[model samples]
Target: MAFRLARNRALIAPAKSALGAIPRTALFYSTSSKPASSGQPQASEAETHFGFQTVKESLKAGKVAEVFSSVASSYDVMNDAMSFGIHRLWKDHFVRSLNPGRKSGGSPMAILDVAGGTGDIAFRMLDHADKINGDRETTVICADINADMLKEGEKRAQQQGYISTNRISFRVENAETLDSIPDNSVDLYTISFGIRNVTRIPMALKAAHRVLKPGGVFACLEFSKVSPAPLDAIYQQYSFSIIPLMGQLIAGDRDSYQYLVESIKKFPTQQEFAVMIKEAGFMNVGKGYEELTFGVASIWKGVKPLDSK
Candidate 1:
């Protein structure tokens, strides 16, 4: 069945009718049972965890790079298969919550979707804005560290008729240092399911802060801590025992999926991450995040103070 971007910004899979969409997963392999820290290597240690295995912090980026490069082509298909298209719903809500696409003062709105290698979020933002304004003045910069992923994103953009329209662009950029993006230029900075993989979460958050204009918003959607003892227990069983199996069946890449699961475990909890956002100089830190899907994933938001610039 083919999937199309629905008017609600959800990815609706081809079905007999509009009402047949239902999400469906299981995996096993994470070694840690508790929620994680920001996952940056401490100053005293030069090593970091790579899916329950320790590796030199300097080498983690390359390893993560290899994983994405291997899966870039199959990324979209696997995402649908694994999540049963539920991720599309999460993404839709993420963009809608921001709704930062309306034209302000007859100028094109700037959105920097960090680590948006495949352009899903960027495309949604463009569609959201244009549907409202009926203009092509909304542009998105889809940035990632992996060229292979960016290439795939560009191909998809072309498929969606985004080529030569100036509605979308791709860039190879590091999250911790957006050297090419000038300070206070971007209106919205978004990172979905990407921040946990960074070598330094604080540095990345700082960089996000630097690039956004005062009053610009920072948004992230990533796996988060789940609650209620019974549900957490079931989720652990499914993620650890079934997700790796799904990875092997869908992409023939079990290890990469295992790493992804482990990274989720190692990511900071919602409250902890909210604090980090505040530390990076964002305001409304207390009300910055919303839990989605009962915390299997979450949306975190913070804004630069309008008085800062």
Candidate 2:
């Protein structure tokens, strides 16, 4: 099935001119959730941009929730198609960087995997945490804004039976704000492929910084700009064209897939994103790229200082 998808992707390359316009269908998809009233404090208008031509700031959570709702059942398949199976490797790298128990002397590690749809990162983290801590417990709260995604993740986790109901928990929460979790509690906070969909990324960074314990780590994995002229061009073609068609063929949801492509283009580059992390009060911010200069994705690491004021 994967081989067939790859061949089909190769045959349907997009033209350079086609990339200039965002699809109207994607930008105007009807959302089931309404934005909170404007009376509530809102992120500054100047800080916003279209996730896919939809006004992005106040409505970002609802719009993003809609996108995931439309594609939740097929989300994993779309991920494999879009990344050509490289997302697994990228996630593995993110986990290995944590070195889960090397310096902690087998103490239990608590992780907050924000926007961890379908438990992909959470499951892996649990496995590695066990290896590192032996009998010590590992707690992961997989939080996401979309309930459908969270339900799906919960179902998958139950099926694996690797996580007892107590060890891994799911919460419906926004990435931009996590009001329920206590400050200075989480040892590591990680969000994979979900930060770009956030309404206020800076606020999300601040929330992450606030949640982590002193000396805790924050890591993110998301789509990034590709490098070197030729591969970059090819990647652009593949993302904007073949990916949406795959969605239509496999998931029956082309518009959501198109939004996925547009959102990636709208995301900050690695350096700019690192700067955002620094602005959130994290220290020693660093970024690592994968898949050669293609820059298909990146893992960013930052530390919340033990002495942060």
Candidate 3:
């Protein structure tokens, strides 16, 4: 079946079809509730992972929505407690690395920050463009599926004096579809610590490719596999032991935080995800990713091919 799909790949856009065309049975590991081996899963019975738990693919979005909504107000606080404020450094580095906005010979940027509901990445992008490059026209649309999260972000933007400046806007959007974003309109597409919660990552990648203008860049920063056997061991212990405790103490939502940690474990390794980026028709540099904080998180980037229409 995999071979057949590979042979027919020319007939379909690889990013759009990769996850949808493959049977869920072929894609994920099953628990004891595995379907019988002889037949395809009923459409309604198709399954995917929600953190470490198996769930109907259709329900994953709602579950994720609940998690984010529950954490919206305390999101920033939990981030500080859980990672000891290191996530801020990672984010700052991520934005500086991109150096968004008008470049040496480029025009002001139109950046779409998917799942950046709390405006962390969006605010940084605007600051980088305005403060670093003197590119005041660079604007960002911060999109997320959860309204409560967007509300928190909007409130923060208002307080930060961005709402009046028209440099950043928030929208309710699904990462997989981006229904309101126009085709070929974005100069850059970014998602930070957000893609793992998506129900269908390949579909999100396809949407990103669709919205980005040819030559536009796609950048993602997400929790990722740590390295060196010893460091991984220590990191795993800290994640499973300390994060949920911090969540309970700070946000009173231990389960959501636990799920978040598990989702990180379930995400693809850096190399595996880089291949997905390439398969989505984006051009990548060799290896295609860089690890930060000893691989606690990583950044991956790709560029839409100039020849793409």
Candidate 4:
């Protein structure tokens, strides 16, 4: 009986020894196979359009900043030369369309104009709200990614007497995140000829939706595809040929203007952009876009739902 018991003990000893030989971590954790790679480029290293050229998505913002900085001082002059002063009329119409300001016995609107660093749209919005709506309490926050552009806006604001009125302010803000802006704080969001320069249009639209109050409006004025092939051809010729030359002559920055024209061409069409706005969780009216000047430009608006969280 003793010999048999000793034999059993010997067998148990080997089993215990084997168990003790195993690593503690191995005993507690199992090895896992590596996840299968999607075989696509990483998002940070993704490619995005910079005018006619494709560039790293991470670098597009820097490139756009350079372009805007180069043209900051002469931006309005170049706009006048390129559009033959018709841009002024377009802007007037755009501001009038929104009809910004205070309602009777209602709170004044809080406006955010993204990428409007030159103060053109900001001034128009404030003017419309002040002069037309008689809303002295309304205020505008003009944001742009470029500091030089914002300086130009501040200069214009000072010149226009808006600085003293305290109705308009400027900030250096990227359209994609707008980190300085609080969520659900804005009553009206406007981006005029600016969204295309954004590295990610969808992200900008989402940010816009995030910042706007429930029932707040999102309005965009942008260059778009022209109707009628003959007219389009004429417009295309002028855009490609004369615009860059005008940029060189007026702004002394040919590359920047060339890039601007290319960026405009790269922008999504009116219908496509409207779909993007709707995808950002905004409610649209009709097709959600209005073509201006034979579709040379377009106006798009969307409203955040009152029931939205």
Model 1, residue 105: distance off in Å is 4.6
lDDT of residue 279 for candidate 1: 93
**Candidate 1 global Cα RMSD:** 11.0
- For candidate 3, write residues 1-309 as lDDT tens digits: 000100111111111111111111111111222112334446767789999999777778888888998999999988987777788888887887778777666567778898887889999999888889898777788888887888888888888888767777777778888876778888789999999998889999999999888777899999988877788888889889999988898899999999999999999999999999999999875468878776788888888988999
Ranked candidates, highest TM-score first: 3, 4, 1, 2
Off by over 4 Å in 3: 1-44
Clashes of 1: 12
lDDT of 3 at 157: 83
Q: Give the lDDT of residue 29 in candidate 4.
A: 11
Q: How far out, in Å, is residue 282 in model 3?
A: 0.7
Query: Per-residue lDDT tens digits of candidate 1, residues 157-254?
Result: 88889876766777778888876677877777899999998877898999999988777778898889877677777877878888888889888888
Q: Model 4, range 199-305, lDDT digits (tens) per residue?
A: 88999999999988787889898999987788788888989999998888888888998999999999998889989999999988667887777787788889888
Candidate 1 local Cα displacement, residue 119, angstroms:
0.5
Provide the clashing-pair count of each candidate structure.
12, 0, 0, 0
lDDT of 2 at 120: 96
What would the per-residue lDDT of candidate 2 be over residues 229-300, giving only the tens digit for each residue?
Answer: 776788889888899999999999988888889999999988888888888998644342233225677777
Better of 3 and 4 by lDDT: 3
Which is the winner by TM-score between candidate 1 and candidate 3?
Answer: 3
Residue 287 of model 4 has an lDDT of: 76
Candidate with better lDDT, 1 vs 3: 3
